[model samples]
Structure formats: C-alpha cells, structure tokens
Target: MNRLNMGRACARAGLSLVAMASLSAWAQSGAERLALAAAAPRLSEVVVTAVRAPQPLTDVLADVTLIDRDQIAQSGAVTIADLLARQPGVELSRSGGPGTATSLFLRGAETRFTAVYIDGVRVDSQSTGGAPWEAIALGQVERIEIVRGPAAAVYGSDAVAGVVQIFTRQGDGPFTPYVGIGAGNRRTGKLEAGFSGKQGALDYSLGLQRDMSRGHDSHPGSNPDRDGYRQTAASGRIGLRLNEAHRVDLTGTYTDMDAQYDGFLPGLDDHGLNRLATLGASWTAQWSPAYSTRLSVSESQQRYEMVPTPPYLSRTRLRNYLLQNQWKEGAHTFTGTLERREDHLVNAPIDQGRHQDGLALGYGYVAGAHTVQLNLRHDRDSEFGGQTTGGVAYGFAFAPGWRATAAAGTAFRVPTLYQRFSEYGQPALLPEKGRNVEIGLHWGQAASRLGVTLYRNRVSNLINFGAPGACLSPFGCFENAGKARLQGLTFMAAHQVAGVNLSASLDLQQPKNLATGTLLARRAQRLLKLAADTRVAQWRLGAEWHLASHRWENAANTSRLGGYGLVNLYASTTVARQWDVLVRVDNVGDRSYQLAQGYPALPRSFFVGLRWTGR
Candidate 1:
C-alpha cells in the first residue's frame, strides 16, 4: 500500500482504540470507581516549573507531567530522549543509536522552541539553538518535570513550546548508599553508585556512573562497521541550614561521552566527543510567615568535537543570575523575579556574546472551586532591544469530579548565534513569535481519570534556510520567510480494573506550514500510546504499546516515511531484602522501523540489572 493509504488506516485504527478505551473507563460503576479511589495512595506532589513557584499538582492550571526516581529506574531507557518519547504530545527523532544526534519535539513544535534547565541552571547551545540531548547523562537525573505549552511569560526566551526541568538527588532522612550493575545485548554494560546522608545541619549527595555499548550499524549503506559509545558522568549536591528560616544549596554535574558514527568520509574511523557541565548555588531566606526570597547563580558549558580529518569543534557557555520573591496569604500568592542571562559561543572563526535582562511578575489564587494564574515578563536584549510576553489561565470545578480549564499565552525565541554570525547567516533576522490558546475538560475519581484538551498555536516570522542573498556564503542563508499553524486534540485516560492499572493517550494534530500547506518534517499526524501494569506475588510486570502514523521526510511532503508500531515488556522483583532485579525486552516483535530517513532503529534487545541498597 502507498504511504497515504497506510496513514489513513493507522488514523482510523488509533481513533477506534481511543474510543474503546474511553468507553471502558466510563462504563465502570460508581461502586467500582469508589473502590479504586480507596485502594489508590494519596500523594501530595508539588511542582515548580508551571509558574516558577512551588504549587500542588492539583492546584496548577497547566498541562504537566512528573516522573519520579522510581519511574526512571524502572523504565530501562538508554537515553533521556528515549524516555521522553513515551510522553503525551511528545516525539523524538535520532540519526543513530545512543549518544547520537537527537531532537525532541514538544506539542509538534521545533526542538529549539523548548527550554531546558538542570538544577535551576539553564542549558542551551548557541550554535544549535537547543539543548544537547545526546550529551546529557540520564543516569544522574533523579526527577524530571515537563510543562507542555508556552511558558515564555515565566521563563524568558526559548520557551515557545514548553519547559523541561531536571533535578539531581537530594540528601534526606538517614544516611544511605546504593550500588547497581547491569549488562545487556550487544555487549552493553553499566555500573553506577551513589550515596546520600544528612549530618547535623548539613546534607550531601554524590553519585558516579559509567556506561559502554557496542551498538548496531547506524548507516549500513555508507559505514558497515559497528558504532559504539562510552560515557562517564558524576553529580554532587550539598546543602547547609544556617537557621530555621535560612538555607544554602550547591549543586554540580559533569559528563563526557565518546560516540562513534559514520562520517562523510566512509573509509576512516570517526568519533564525536561531547562534554556537558553545570554548576549552581542558591540561598533562601524566609523573612516572615508569608514572605520569602531566594537568590541564585548558575553556569553551564557544552563542548562538541569531531575526531580525525574534517575537524569540527563548537563550544557554548551560559550563565544565569536570578532574584525571586514570593508573598502568600491564605489562597492568594504573588511572585516577582529579576533575572539576567549571558550567552557565549565559540566555533572556529565565529566568536560572539550577548545578554538578556528580564523582569517578571506572577499572581496565583486557589480558593474553593476556582483557580487562576497570571504572568507577565519583559526582556531587554543587548542585541535586539526589548520584547514582552504574557499568559493567563483559569480553571473552574462545577461538578463533584469534573473541571474545565482555558489558557492563552504568547512566546518568542531569539535567533541563534549561528543564524546571525556564521558563514551562512543573516544579521537582520527577526525573532520567531507564537500565540497559543487551549481549552480542556478533566474528570477524576481517585485512580480513575479522563481528560481531553484542544489547542491552536499560530507562529509568525518562522526562520528557515533560503537562497543566499544577504550572506557571504554561496549556499544558503537563514531568513524569516515562513508561517506555521499547529492545532491538535489530545485525549488521555487512566483507570484501575481488577488488579491491573492501565493508561492511554492519543494525539491528533496538524502541524503545517501556512506558506506551502505541507506538514512539518518528520512529525506524525496521529499518535497513540498505551500501558498496563500489575503485580503478581513478588514480581511487577508491565507492558507498553506505541503507534504513529506516516510522516514526511522533508518540507515538500514528497518523500514519505512509513508508519510503525512497537511493543515493550518489563518485569522487576526483589531478590533479597536489600537486592532488586529487573529485566526488560524492547521491540518484542523485532519490528523494522526508522525514525529518520537513513537511520535504522534498534531491533529486539534484552536487558537485566541488579541493585543493592544499604539501609
């Protein structure tokens, strides 16, 4: 069958699956719902990325997902991108195996549109316009918070799509230490160790990890040799409590990776060396019962280089300083922040630096059955003058278990240094701007929940490479010559039936260029994800299914990439009081698929690990 026919069939199948799941969830009796609710554990989870302040998950008015340490250890994912792909309204594309060039699309927006932060420190590449996903070490991450949709009003630039925050482990409770080792197919091996403890008024955490893998062939047509990767990472955190109302924190992380891949020259061995490092310090003081303040300073550096001939090297350094104040009384909350960011890039003949200073204000109210949030920010750029952004959101609960929400926001992203100072650049390029509006309906009864959201985002002054006329290079130049519209409907459901817990999500979206009327490259129009887990005796078993419709390989939509489906299974059990064992099988059917045009995805793989904790 042709790609178009196949795409249609997949869409129909996804719709049918969604309908069946929704009906099954809604068909449960009131008694069953109550029983499920009673059996479920109550968690008072707090999130900080939604409005840049700590708030209960139940009180936030935005779309968000939180992944704790337990989930991360059970996922058996080799990279951060691999783990994020299973999230709702998110997709990933990679050129090869682990540690390869990767891109993450949030809500069908460009990878560069999303902002990334680690331990409250911003991390971005001025040469590429986004975070270096390949260089980041997932093993060092203790938790992750993802906020989907524009957050520029709270975080200045590079938040046109969303924001991702990664947190390292914190010291708490009694002293504890842990060690883990694992091996998998293709000669993959992993070793990790960590310790955390609290002594007197000080707390500290330290961790180290090493991983190596003999990966599969990335480009069979060009390089027939096996591509492999080696990585080493470390993380540390320290905190001191001076008094009951004052505290100071210090955090840092570093990682080095060497990944082999096929370069343009086929006969020679080629490798990509990547390094990432981040450091941050913060001080918090509670001056009054309802007022608090915090001051922080952070820095991050990223370096990338190619070995042997065809030498290439690029480095990016980012520094951030912030002062934040919060005031709270009963159900009313107010926040104000002053932030400054400096960016520096060095790539061969190009060396440039820029700075942005921003002031932001936010207000939140959660009283009775009503919740509201308002944010506004203004940034002054040394190179581009000034820009302003704002957002407003509201939620109302009219029934016992039902809520309706609506939100609107504006965001912008400044042009990357490479787009304005490199060989093929346009110094007059303009920052891309986006306007978004969304509405949602949600129903929850303990462990059982159902939600539907519709969103429309329009972006103007989109930047793309065009025929060279304003640059010295003869090839092409970056220009703001396009417009795009991203509209979508997302459905999510979770329920407990018998002894099994189930969850599902479906996304139907049209991310298209308004100028040529073509779908965005490598973005599927339909996506579906499903998972179920249950406990038997001492074992916990889970299964996941992922499906996506066909996608276009390029902007013209003439080159078609076929649709595919994948299934994965995992099981974990306690061997001894202090020992844990986990086994996972990915791509159970050994299905052949490709996330990019020339790169083949991994085949069926097996992995097992054992961990021991000292209490």
Candidate 2:
C-alpha cells in the first residue's frame, strides 16, 4: 500500500465522470413516464414473499433494508458489491479489482459473522463463514433483502452480524429470454443470459453470466504482472404448485473464480482460486387457510486454492448440508433448523479440521400492537461440543406509521483452521464467543422510509493474527488475545420529491479492548454515505459520496491509514421498448484511501452496458 499503488485506484475514479454526460437517448417518450408516476405507490404489491408472508419491515423487530427490482434497475449496477458498498453499516473491500475474494463487515462485526443466503438456502462458508461477494453476479438477481444487525432469531450461527438474502427470478412469464455482451477498459468483458417459462402446473427458469478483467495498475505490481481476474457462473431453478395447497422449489448453482493478486506489493505475489457448487429443494404446503408448513433441504461444497494451485500448496475445503422446517398457525410462527457442516484444511504437512451439527428453534407471536420473538440453538462443535445459544426480541408499534424494537442475543465463532493446527504456525488458540444487544425504530409512509438502530456487542476470546516473526515471520499466526466491546448507531433515510429520490446513511462504531485500553486496529469508528437519484422521462441519474474515519493497522504503533472520501455517478436511459443503456463512474475523486488503513483501495474507473427491460 504505497502512494504509487494508491494512484492506480485514483485513476479509475477520474474516468467515471466523463461517462455521465453520454446518457439520455433520443427515444423514451413522455407517455411511459406518466404511466409509472400514477402506479408508483403500488410497486411493492408485486413481491410474493412480502405478500404471502406479510411481515412488515417493522414487524421483524430488527433493522432491515429492502432493495426491490425497481431500485436495482435504477441503480445500473453490475455486481452485488456495488449495491452493498453504498448501503449503511456495511463496507466491502478487495485487493484491487472485480472477481477477487471480497470481505464484507456489518456495523463493526468481522467478515465471518455475516451470513448470506440465496432463495432461503445458506451460501456462506461451512468453515470460515461469510459469503464470497464476488461470486454473486447481478444478472440473475430479481431483488435483494438485507437484514442488518444480530439475527440469531431467524437464521443460525455466524448470523451475529446480519443476514443478506438474494432471490433469483423463477420465471414470471412463459418463454421469456434475454442475452447480453459488453466490454470496457482493461479488457473487461461480460456475457449474460437467462430465460423463464411455465407449462401447466410447473414453472422454471435458468440464468448464466461471466465477467473478466485484465485489470490495470490499481497497485504497483512487484513483478509487472497484469493483475488479471475472471469468474464464470450459472444458476437454474424449477418451481411447481399444486392446487394452492402445496408448493415446491428446486435450485442449483455453480461458480468458478481466479485472480492473480501478484501481491499488493513485493512478496505478496499470491494467486487465489475459488470454486463452489450448490443444490437445494424446498416445499411449502397449507393444511388449511389458517395453518401452513414449509420445509427445505440443501447441500453445498466449496474449494479454495491459494498461491500455487492445489496439490503444490495450501488449500481449504468446505461442505455444508442443512434442513429447515417452519409452521404457521393463527398469530403464531415456529421455525426449526438442523444443519451439519465440515471444514478441512491442508497446509503442507499440517492438517486441521472442524465438524459441527447445529439445531435452532424459534417462536414468534403478535399481540395487540406488539410483536415478540424467542430463539434458541443447539450446537456440537469439534472443538467445543454440546452448546445452546438463544435470544429474545420485541417490537411495539409506538404511533401511526412508527415502530420500536429491541433484541438481545448470544453467539459464538469457531476457531480458524490455521489457529488450531498450523504446524508451521501458532496452534493453540480457541473459539471466540459473544453477546449482542440492540434497539431500533422504523417508520414509513407513502413516499419515504426512515430507520435507526443502536447496538452493543461484548466478545471474549478475540483471535489475534499475531505479529511478524523469524520462526513465524510473514506467514501470520493467531491467539485468544483479549476481550472487547463494540458500540454503534446505524441510521438510514430515503425519500422522493418531484422526480428525484434521495437517500443517506451513517454508521458510527467504537470498538475497544478493556484489558489494554486500546482501540481495535483497522476498524473505523465512523462511516457516512449520501446519494441522490432522479429520473426525467426515460433518463435516470444517481450520485454518491462516502467518508470513513482513519484507524491503526496494528496496535503496536506501527502505521496508520489516513481518512478519505470517494464519490461515484450512475446514469441510464431507455434506447427502445426492449433496450436500455447504462454508464457509471466510480471513485470519482481519485482518492487514494485504504479501507483497512494499508491495503490498496480500488482505483477510479468507468463501465457502460446495454440491457433489455421487458419481454
């Protein structure tokens, strides 16, 4: 992370500004705009889960954000990270460019504590935890619903931070198909297509997309390597319904990704590869109008290769299998989940393993203007066997269109493979565990949404990636160094005026270790985001700005990464009834900022694409 590498990211930001003026096509008449403006308030009525389940955002008793299809099309984004990076209480980072393994943090929680799901199926790592954001391309998505803050109530372990659920389309129509191809700077190319159809009582859909970048110098490569990255992915699903009493869904996905890190600087020349496959099926049926049940089962396998491919070096393998059942009766809802997971690692002559079987149960009810939920989980871990964790939550309607909520939960994190059995490194550390308490408020009306939340987390057995050494110098090790507390506030507000929509969010966190009286390094105490989106006729425009507070890279008084702010712009317009165009400029300030104080930040760049909106 030197200035030269910083400049590479800056260059990319500067290139995006020039792309905005190029939007606004000659087509897209005035009539279409009038039709949408009249039907705008009914936009949410199109969602199935929201309608059939009918859990109001405030009823969940937690802080949540829903990005519907309209917003996705309006943002003109090409990847999932693009949408998340602009959100409140979340930040995403990579070594340099797209298709690289991404890290996401919620509030001040670590990456592994967040859980990701695709169509109700868990997509996170079986061992390390957390989803690989780069592996999820945008082409196949219908909409995304993100529940931020501790979520031990509905989901299982590693949900101490939050849950991000993605729902792919299952073909809303019959025989609908689309294909697209595009290219950008640094030899970036994209190919994507999907089709949906139905016959009688059954409906099905499939989609595929690939993105590749022969990236530029977002950093000064030690060996003048081109810093290349590529990803290929495809997903398919089938849905069947019988007489409105029974419903079934089956899904499958495959992804492969490769990136040449070439090390951000000298001696960091490591290449990484990740491949994953997932398959799952679910069934939901109604015994009557007042009582219903849902059941699902899934399996997934993922392999990680670092440095020199598989056989020649270090690698990690993860396998996960899960089952969940839920029953709804009157105002009462009960859910049960059972899962088995394994994480296997190989580092030369050293081997480490972790196996876990966990079950979680929850009950929720609505009384008067208040909603209450209770949760419990039973787990048997390889290192620590037979444990139960749970939480309680309450949401009360305070006033017209306003709700208040609070929750308290207990959670734990398993030890890393290297922490337990790295023969060439430290091997004595144990698991980390913690408790979280939070409170929030939510309010929404016709044209606006406002949400605010306050939370605190106390964690013990915090793992430390120990300092550089001779016997254990560059390779890194770990330990249960100390206990700490993280306290923060998250707030977001969005509103529409005239033809323009505006949104803003702020995340403030202070993490400290009581034992050492020191702030946790590389974790920012404050982050802020602001954006504006407006549409006129067929033309749409959006702009964003972000600022992050500085923090230490290490507590030993080594170095500090300075604070910086970055900006981005997006614009799009319809070309014809079937075609549309998009242009985006990211990191417009060309600021050389570090998300972790030293790791290289992404460079300034621009991307343009053509898409189709309807069949």
User: Which candidate has the highest TM-score of all?
Assistant: 1
Q: How close to the true structure is residue 246 of candidate 1, measured as C-alpha lDDT?
A: 100
Give per-model TM-scores: 0.95, 0.84
lDDT at residue 40 of model 2 (Cα atoms): 47
Error of 1 at 317 (Å): 0.3
Candidate 2 has which clashing residue pairs, if any? 9-603, 9-604, 12-604, 12-605, 13-587, 13-604, 13-605, 16-585, 263-268, 469-473
Model 1 scores a TM of: 0.95
Report every candidate's CA lDDT. Answer: 0.86, 0.66
lDDT of 2 by residue, 272-379 (tens): 777766777878777776666666677665666776523334455555665555677778877677777777766656566777888878787876677887878888
Q: Which residues of candidate 1, in runs, are more than 4 Å off?
A: 1-41
TM-score of 2: 0.84
Candidate 2 deviant stretches above 4 angstroms: 1-58, 76-78, 126-129, 264-270, 307-323, 342-354, 424-428, 467-476, 555-557, 596-599
Instruction: Report how far residue 162 has shifted in candidate 2, in Å.
Output: 1.6
Q: Note each model's CA RMSD in angstroms.
A: 3.7, 8.0
